[model samples]
Target: MALIKCSECGKEISDTVESCVHCGCPLGKVIFNTGNSWIGVFGKYIITDESGNVLAKLKENQQFEMNIVEDTTFYVQCNTSIRRNKVKVCVPAGEINKFLVKLGFLGIVTVVSKID
Candidate 1:
């Protein structure tokens, strides 16, 4: 069996497992990727896997959700300020670092602009 680093826990694990034994992260055969688009003036975004599963969905000026396949789901609210050109994400939980790491660099992220 080939061992790979778990994206959620950074631990070595067999790539054949369906989930990370340590962190309970989904380790199915899928490559995680993100996509965003401006639909008629507003924006819509989604983080998808190679199997075309929507892990997270986001709107331009609305809240978003993450992890539909997992038992533990995280709901996050977000807003983009045009005046400062910044996007802010808020969650009720105080801890977020681990959760961010679990997502493995693909999620609903609001940026200043596509060009910049």
Candidate 2:
């Protein structure tokens, strides 16, 4: 088997494993999308894990995909100097999970799994 780096804990692991033994982060992929909008033009949005570890920084109209545990609930927050928005998401195994992040009225951040 090939060795790969665990996306969550950055430890070397066998690619055949179902989960990262080091941090329990599963090998499933999830997508996070930040659509292009005027509200996001000013600053970057920070995405972090439940333990407050930063995963990615997204700008307007950007998309990021990462590994996550299947059928588990995780939290992510959008942080800025004036406002913060936290979102909880759960993705089932063997299915595609896509989330959209947006800035709402009065600089409030919102994240939704469905477009409609």
Candidate 3:
């Protein structure tokens, strides 16, 4: 469970929690998404509240790669879960670029991307 500030009380609480501990505000289930995962070259994140309301959006700031080394970063701009500040996330590009690699080659296969 990700820790995020309560939307109603501005208190730190777990997104998986049913309600705020301090204010007793309903948080339901927080939703996190990358908008679209088909084209993940540029990483992105979207966080939402229990009511299906947008809370934060994070986008990749810069990426660098050399030889076998890779680096990708994201800046999270959040008001509730992030204390209204921008948070950075760094990850190796190759680590997250292996979903299709695991799928192997199909020679003649159609690709479909879906939104949830």
Candidate 4:
């Protein structure tokens, strides 16, 4: 099992748990996506939490999903030596929290939360 910080209390806890032991906050799933478009095929993207924890590395047309407590924010950044782009995503309490990452003009990155 891996340890993750509780979103409610910021305490380290097992990732396999259903709720935070410190704050009793319920766990939810956040789905991160890099669209299957041609623009995203150029480089890699890094996903992280608010604490600068690396959550996942995504390529073009790839996705990463994780369990996190309610009301948390995640950071998505382009993995590059130059012209790095970053975006922040706020996830709400739900089972279907989805976020999309895309590269815009001049390698600028953008994150959009999917509402469904």
Top TM-score hit: 4
Q: Model 2, poorest ten-residue lDDT window?
A: 67-76
lDDT of 4 by residue, 85-104 (tens): 56778887635587777666
Error of 1 at 113 (Å): 31
Question: What does the lDDT come to for candidate 1?
Answer: 0.37
Which residue segments of model 2 deviate by more than 4 Å?
A: 1-27, 40-42
lDDT of 1 at 17: 68
- 1-116: candidate 2 lDDT, tens digit per residue: 67877767889987667788898776765777878744444566667766777778888788877654345455655565255667777666434567787766666665555443
Over 4 Å off in model 3, which ranges? 30-116
Candidate 1 Cα misplacement greater than 4 A, ranges: 30-116
Q: List clashing residue pairs in candidate 2.
A: none
Candidate 4: segments with Cα more than 4 A from true spot = 1-26, 39-42, 81-83
Residue-level lDDT for 37 in candidate 2: 42
Could you tally the backbone clashes for each prediction?
0, 0, 0, 0
Q: Candidate 3 lDDT, tens digit per residue, 1-116?
A: 46776666787776555667798765432122332223234333443333445445444332221111224343333222222333333433222221110011231221212223
List the global CA lDDT of all models.
0.37, 0.66, 0.36, 0.73
Estimate candidate 4's alpha-carbon lDDT, on a 0 to 1 scale: 0.73
Ten residues in sequence with the least summed lDDT for candidate 3: 98-107
TM-score to native of every candidate shown? 0.26, 0.62, 0.26, 0.65
